[model samples]
Target: MAKDNTTAGIIVRTYMVGALFLLVFYGVIFYNLTLYTEDRNSEKRLQLLSEYYSEKYDLADFDTIQIDPLLTIYGDYSNLPDTLSAQFSESWVGATTFHIDNDEEYSVLAQRIASASGNQTIYFVEAIGSVELDQVDIILFQSMLTGAGIFLFLIAAAYITRSARKIGGPISSLSNQLEASESDFSPINLSGHLPDETKQMLSSVNAYRARIKRALHREQLFTRYISHELRTPLTVIKGSLSVLRKSGNDKTLKHVGLMSTSVAEMEELTQTFLLLAREKLDRDVVAVDEQLVDRLLENFSGLIQRNEVHVTRVLSAPFSLDAHPQLFSAVINNLLKNAINCSLGGKVSIFLSPERIDVIDNGVGLGEKPRGYEGFGIGLKIVNDICDKYGWMFKLEPNPSRGCTATVLLK
Candidate 1:
């Protein structure tokens, strides 16, 4: 971008322009003040010296009088211009000032003072060409300094602009990536290490990307799960129809009831899936169905037997969770798995109340667990995320009696 167009670039350009204006104004004022003031002072000093000489010395003794190097006195002043001589001859003033032009490089200022004797006219001449030459040198020096200042400013401005672009590059790229279609969504990977603020912004962007990815994954999984769940009931209904065809009229009612039960189960599962798959949690109000826990335990029966772990249940009857069943099941599954793994042959306690579920185990506490414990595992992380999504309170802390106790308080 042009230096005068971008935000920082414009600021630098404006400052440089203002500085240049100030420099020019200062140079003009300085040059004029010094030049005119010096000229006036010099003229006054020369006039005083000429008066002293006229009062104290004869015309012949003018050569003995002290004078400035740039000044000279002439008692036999005969080479004046015709017009100037005529003017001075008629004028009755005590002194007259004149500018004399000649072939020499320097201009001369001649002040004529009438001597004590009327016949002699004394001329005081001063060369002022050196002052003009010094003025030129002063202007050149000021110009050079101003140019150097502007050059350095441009370099600094360029560096600042480049740095700003570097800092914003990652964020800009992330924004472009986010603007893509949902199907085209992908992880954002920034190339190099950036400043802390930019890094934080990139982290937030990546977090948002992860959220989108999870939501999409859930969408795909929901579709697959719905199809899979529907197939079981469909197969049951088909098998029952085959049975009805083979059996006599007495068993016809049994086959019909079987088909009806399959249909009812499919409907229930569908409703559950729909509730769990919803994007918003505003309508979530999961009532505790007694069969929900029965199904969960039945599903985990094989794992329970393999682990050879004793289970103690203190669940309140007619309980419910104020959350989607799928999400609640996930949280329970992760916590239960972690509790079982940490139990190490010890008894695992499952205490449930109207508002919360507590899984207490007598295994090594979180502090004593190895580095790769469930604290850093994907399951525990998912459990935490689910709990956070539904505004549930979850804590996996070390129990006062022994190992860790996992608690999930539903809102």
Candidate 2:
């Protein structure tokens, strides 16, 4: 899933987002931990004072006020003022807070140290301002720690960002180089300054490129070999037919001309197949010199008659196209052949417009394209490739009338 998104985006978002969460989590945890430590220390101080004073000042000697270096002991509940009494009543063991002076408060512990004298409430007051000062130091430490963590994180992020770009830069460069090379069908080259990993990747790409070039070389050789081999026989046959046309009777001359035409078309098809393989045509553009609909229908007349299919040609105007006749005819022939093959003695309509040509057939309507039709399928695939090379729009869709429509738009 991460592969679908950009690499840099994922890296930045994941790292930055995770860092923020960690900072927040740690800040809360550290602050609470400091507060907990302060509370525990205060409790310990109160407990020690209570133990020491309990040993020295017995319950029988319950004095109202007993001063010490660390603590000011208050004896008996009734001795405390009304307001102080109310405040002390609310104090807990370790978290006790009460006023020591008008402006200052002390954190202390309340306890009942009893003996045979009677129950007496005593306040073990801690020395003033210690707990408040600790709290101030904790706040300052928390701020400094948070600032330091942020500074460290920023430095780490900068380092990581630089490192990512360094590592990812060459990879991105290699990828772009591969794309450009593939698009132009050229060799890929990487700079010698690249890192070892990048060098390895470039080596792999170059090896793959070599393999493709070799395969293409073989294909071109085979095409040339087959075309030369076939042309020799075709040339001889055409010569023989030309001679026969001159010497034979009128009916024989007609048959010879048809044979000659078929031979020529076959020769053109051989050249077309070669051009398709090379993905380059001799002519970039050609003007329409013949009625395309009439030519195609006449060429496939025999097939139409055999299949008992009705053909209709509807033209808005004399159709104009910017394509070589041979290539255009090949495309039309493949589409027409497929339509005829799929239809069961049904109608095949050829609609010609200023911008497009549509061959629609009331047939099987493209239901599960039948396989094992390689000879015909390859021809159609070549047609599609030609259309793509020429930047023409080709679409095949099922028609509402239980048929399929193949549209070729010249743009």
Top model by lDDT, which number?
2
Candidate 2, run of 10 with poorest lDDT: 367-376
Determine the C-alpha RMSD for candidate 1 after optimal superposition of all C-alphas.
17.4
Off by over 4 Å in 1: 1-278, 281-285, 367-376
Which tens-of-lDDT digit does each residue in 1-411 have in candidate 1?
434454445555666677678767866786777656656665676678667766666655253223666556655546543544554553333443344354122222344445555455455655554543364676787788668767876786677667656655666666666676344556666687667886787778778878987887888687668767787767777676777767748577665755655575455445544544555656555656556666666555555666667877776866655676666776776677777776666778877777788988888778665334445566677677777767878888887888888888865
Candidate 1 lDDT: 0.64
Residue 236 lDDT in candidate 1: 75
lDDT value, residue 213 of candidate 2: 81
How many collisions per candidate?
A: 1, 0
Error of 1 at 26 (Å): 50
Model 2 C-alpha lDDT per residue in residues 10-72, reported as the tens digit of each score = 676678889989998999999988656655676687777678767776544465655555466
Q: What is the C-alpha lDDT of each candidate?
A: 0.64, 0.73
